[model samples]
Target: MNHLKVLALSAGALTLVPGLALAHGSMRPSHGGVVQMSGEIMVELVTKPKALEIYVTEEDEPIPAADFDGTLIVTAPGGAKTRSALKAVSGNKFVSSGRPGSGSKVVVSLIEKKSSAKTFASFTMK
Candidate 1:
């Protein structure tokens, strides 16, 4: 009985390997920022005292800035919400000159310049 149970568990574990191998982007920050994955794409957000920057990538490949435009909507600690537009600075990097204070929630939306495909990500300030 115990041997049969072990075999069943092993078969179940093996079945999960493919899904794990095809898992989404990395969580390790590449540019000293916070990262989240949307499908196969990775979104990284960096907060500064006077600005907020976002970076996007897929499978470790940088997504060109010229291909997308994005916006950030931040909910402040005191409950006020502010919207800021992001301008591409370089490949995979977009910047906006305002920050949502710590403990706030930031939502970023991007529209592909050519295809018009859209993607979104949300992060809580640290």
Candidate 2:
């Protein structure tokens, strides 16, 4: 019957809505920082007075920081740019020593060691 087909179609469509909503996963920062999505990976930028920490995750699960080589690029409000290498401290944490001034734009680039694939995440220091 037409009514039965319509009901089934509506139910199927409703099911897909939830999947679409979850496709992007959570954007909330778990490490008290700003979060950005790079393809399927999530990058979190945590800024400290003396250091900057980067966290990488996929589907909320951490991907080992040691698996990639990374760089931290910071651009000041006056257009001055500084680059520093990020070292893997432990687990999913990549860190660099430096404080980006307020209003500075910070970008972290991670290159997978095995595949040479790059993932980038950017943030504005506040």
Candidate 3:
């Protein structure tokens, strides 16, 4: 009877392991920037003086650079809008040539090259 009880306890513990693994995701900014999730992917935006860099990943796995076309739209506080085309630089990172200023509204869109499926994330610059 004790052996059967121990086996039951072990099976219950094993069930929790996979559930914990599925909860894994990184909200800690890897690049010292803002991080947000669009569906299952994490989008990290790093703003520089002259450019904007977006890093995309799914559960910490790098999404292929050649798989998508991306764009960034920046809307200023005064309602001016600027759009930049992002090109993949390296390792799941897409970069465009404009600095969306502080408090500005920014929208990022990535369209899959093969399926044309779209994914979007919106952020307000800080």
RMSD of each: 4.9, 3.1, 3.4
Looking at candidate 3, the ten consecutive residues that score lowest on lDDT are 16-25
Question: lDDT tens string, model 1, 20-70?
Answer: 456455678988998888767788998777888899999888899778888
Judged by TM-score relative to the true structure, which candidate is superior, 1 or 2? 2
Question: Which pairs of residues collide in candidate 2?
Answer: none
Candidate 3, residue 16: lDDT: 70
By TM-score, how accurate is candidate 3?
0.79
> Which model is ahead, 1 or 2, in terms of lDDT?
2
Worst 10 residues of 2 by lDDT: 16-25
For all candidates, the clash counts are 0, 0, 0
Return the clash pairs for model 1, or none: none
After TM-score superposition, the amount by which residue 86's alpha carbon in candidate 1 deviates from its true location, in angstroms, is: 0.4
The top-ranked prediction according to TM-score is 2
| TM-score-based ranking | 2, 3, 1
**What would you estimate as the lDDT of candidate 1?**
0.86
* Per-residue accuracy of model 2 over 1-126 as CA lDDT, tens digit each: 999999999999998775543465678999999899999999999987799888999988899999999999999999999999999999999888788899999999999999999998888999
Count clashing pairs, candidate 2: 0
